[model samples]
Target: MRFPGFTGEWKETTAAETCSEFKSGKGLKAENILSEGLYPVYGGNGLRGYTSTFNHDGFFVLIGRQGALCGNINIAEGKSYITEHAIAVQANTENVTGFFQYLLLNMNLGQYSDQSAQPGLAVNKLLKLRINLPSKEEQQKIATMLSLLDARIATQNNIITTVC
Candidate 1:
C-alpha cells in the first residue's frame, strides 16, 4: 500500500546493493555468557545472554543463520555482542536501518533456509535476494510510523506482564 503524497515506484535492488555490510557475527563461547554483564549477546534465538565483551556497537539488523530458527531477524543497538549464529546487516547511506528491519521482518526469511538437519541461511544467498525501496524521505516516514507502533505494542505487553 502506498502512503499519501508518496509518488513514483520504489526502486528494485538486491540486499547487497542497499547494505554496506552483510557478514556473520564473531564467535562467542557459551562460557563467556553471563547472567549479568556489560553487553547483551545475540544468538540465533536472540538475546542469548549478557557478556563482558562486545563485538558490535550502534544500530544494525541481525539475521539468525543456523538451527530451526534460521532466518529470524532482530534489531540490535548500542554495545552488544552478535554471536556467530547471527548475520549482521548494516544499511548503506541511502537507506534507513529501521526501514530495513521492518522489511526483513516481513520477508519470512525462513523459507530461504537450506534444507538440512539444522536449517541455515547462507549470507551470500540472502545478499543476492531482490528487494524494493522507496525514497529516503518515504523510508524515514514509514520506519518512524512502524517503530512507534512497535513501541506501543511493547508497552502493552509490559503492562500485561505486570498485571497478570
Candidate 2:
C-alpha cells in the first residue's frame, strides 16, 4: 500500500537488485577486539565490542546472519568492524539506504531463516526476498518521518531511564 499523498504503486524487487553489496563480514576474531579501540565491532545482535581496525568505511545496513536473533537489522555508519555473524548491505544508491533499512526492519526475515540447532540467515535466500519500493521522493519522505520518530523514541527512553 502506498503512503498518503504518494502516487502509483510501489515496484517489487529483490534485496540483491536494490543493494549493490550484500556480503558477510569477515576476519574479525573476538580475541582481536580491543577495549580501547577506534572503531565499533558489530556482531549479530549489535555492538559486541571495539576494534582497532574497520573493514567497512561508509553507511550500511547490517543483518544478523546467525544467532537466536537472526534477521535483526541495524545500521552502521563511518568506519566499523562487522563480525562474520552479520551481513552488510549497501544500497545501490544513496537515497535508498534509510528506506531499505526501514524495509528490512519491517520484514519478517526470521520466516525465511534456516531452521536448525542454530538459526541462520542465508545471504542467497535473503537476496531473493521481494521488496516493494516507492519513488525516491516518497522513500526520502518516509525515511525522514521514521528517523524523526526514532529520535523522539530514543529521547523518551533516555528520559524514562534517567527518571527510573
Please, what is the TM-score per model? 0.94, 0.93
What is the Cα-based lDDT of residue 85 in candidate 1? 95
lDDT of 2: 0.87
lDDT of each candidate versus the true structure: 0.92, 0.87
Q: Residue by residue across 59-100, what tens digits does model 1's lDDT show?
A: 989999999989888978999999889999988999998899
Q: Per-residue lDDT of 34-63 in model 2, one digit per residue for the tens? A: 777899998888888898889999988899
Q: Compare the candidates by TM-score and give the number of the best one.
A: 1
When summed lDDT is taken over every stretch of 10 residues in candidate 2, the lowest stretch is: 91-100
Give the runs in model 2 whose Cα sits over 4 Å from its true position: 1-5
